[model samples]
Target: MSHSEQTIEREIVSKGLTAPRLTPTSIDEAIKDEHYWVAPGRRLTVCALTLRNGFIVTGESAATSSENFDEDLGRKIARDNAREKIWQLEGYLLRQRLHDA
Candidate 1:
């Protein structure tokens, strides 16, 4: 479901309930920029997310075996890890807004 605050408010109005939730679109919206970096040996990858407010969050992935390291997979894993952090942060913001409302 769309997770914009407006959308959630509408849902609550119609449903007569309150439950703050986060959605993919909300996460995507809060992210102002995204970047990735690989370590010198290419066995580790880090993903950085720049939020709309200019704060940065990062997550990383490391390969236990050099032979199994893949740049594409590492980027995906690292990005996912970073996105998870975004979820937590966004969730907190959502809950705070709901509480204040």
Candidate 2:
């Protein structure tokens, strides 16, 4: 997490609104499986994550120049993008759960 994000999370935790309820560790654990691959015949990396509840989310990373394409870097970027989406989705789910409570 970025310094700013850590600060914000500390503030929220201090207020007891939403902190321990939806944590980064929990988010990481919520994923049941993960997969990554480069697009055939292209310099694009695709990441797929399957949530514990069987929901799937995908993210992609592309190289501007084929000459500079690095498979390892592309996979990292793509997987990070996919995990970021999971954060957003899980945040929404937590909000809904709070509302319904």
Candidate 3:
């Protein structure tokens, strides 16, 4: 990857790592839907935790809005984004597991 691509990738991972963990937080399904307001009007973060076959998985979203900001919409969008990230992570993890197997 090019320098810019690497930077972008790092940013993405950083966002996931730095996202605020909601109440009852854990790697497991102890928490279902957790929302965190990262910035007053700039961004909102959310996460979902689940367990599958004794494995824990998490999904996160960092939603961004500039004009016409709405908290409800922002939260919804953030959750959707997090779910997308979770799917990507799941695929990557599955691939790694297969390779290691």
Candidate 4:
């Protein structure tokens, strides 16, 4: 097919790797609904896990104050933040699992 089509196919296959062993209910749940918080006037929440392998996997739908992010800047920001949080959580889980072992 076209170069873009091939690129998309490769991307899809590459993402199939690093699949988690256990699919926890919350693993696919939205970060915001999972954890709620208030920041005085503004509130923030996580809606997905950003994988180190460069995959944006969502356990639940994302929430945003903006009506539309056509430029996708909001998506990029959310993905970055979620990825950081997911990485941190993964580290914590790994340590805990090892400790339990």
Q: In order, what is each prediction's RMSD in angstroms?
A: 5.4, 2.5, 12.7, 10.2
The best candidate in terms of lDDT: 2
* TM-score for each model: 0.77, 0.79, 0.41, 0.34
Computed on alpha carbons, the lDDT of every model, listed in order, comes to 0.83, 0.85, 0.48, 0.44
Tens-place lDDT per residue, model 3, 1-101, is 23554576577677776533321112223324454464655654444444344333333444444565556766666555554445455556656777797
lDDT of 2 at 55: 100
lDDT of 2 by residue, 2-96 (tens): 46657877887788794437676777898999998888756899999999999999889999988888999999888888988888899899899
Model 1: which ten-residue window has the lowest total lDDT? 1-10
Q: Write the per-residue lDDT of candidate 1 for residues 1-89, one digit (tens) a residue.
A: 22455576676679866455765767888889989999988799999989999999898999997889999999988887887788788
Ranking by lDDT: 2, 1, 3, 4
Backbone clash numbers for all candidates listed: 0, 0, 1, 2
Candidate 1 overall Cα lDDT vs. reference?
A: 0.83
lDDT of 2: 0.85
Candidate closer to the true structure by TM-score (higher is better), 1 or 3: 1
TM-score winner among the candidates? 2
- Residues 1-101, candidate 4: write the lDDT tens digits: 33554575577567895543322323334233222222232323334554444455433223355343222444445554453455446556766887797
Q: Which residue pairs does candidate 1 place in steric collision?
A: none
TM-score of 4: 0.34
| Candidate 2: residue pairs that collide | none
The alpha-carbon lDDT assigned to residue 26 of candidate 3 equals: 26
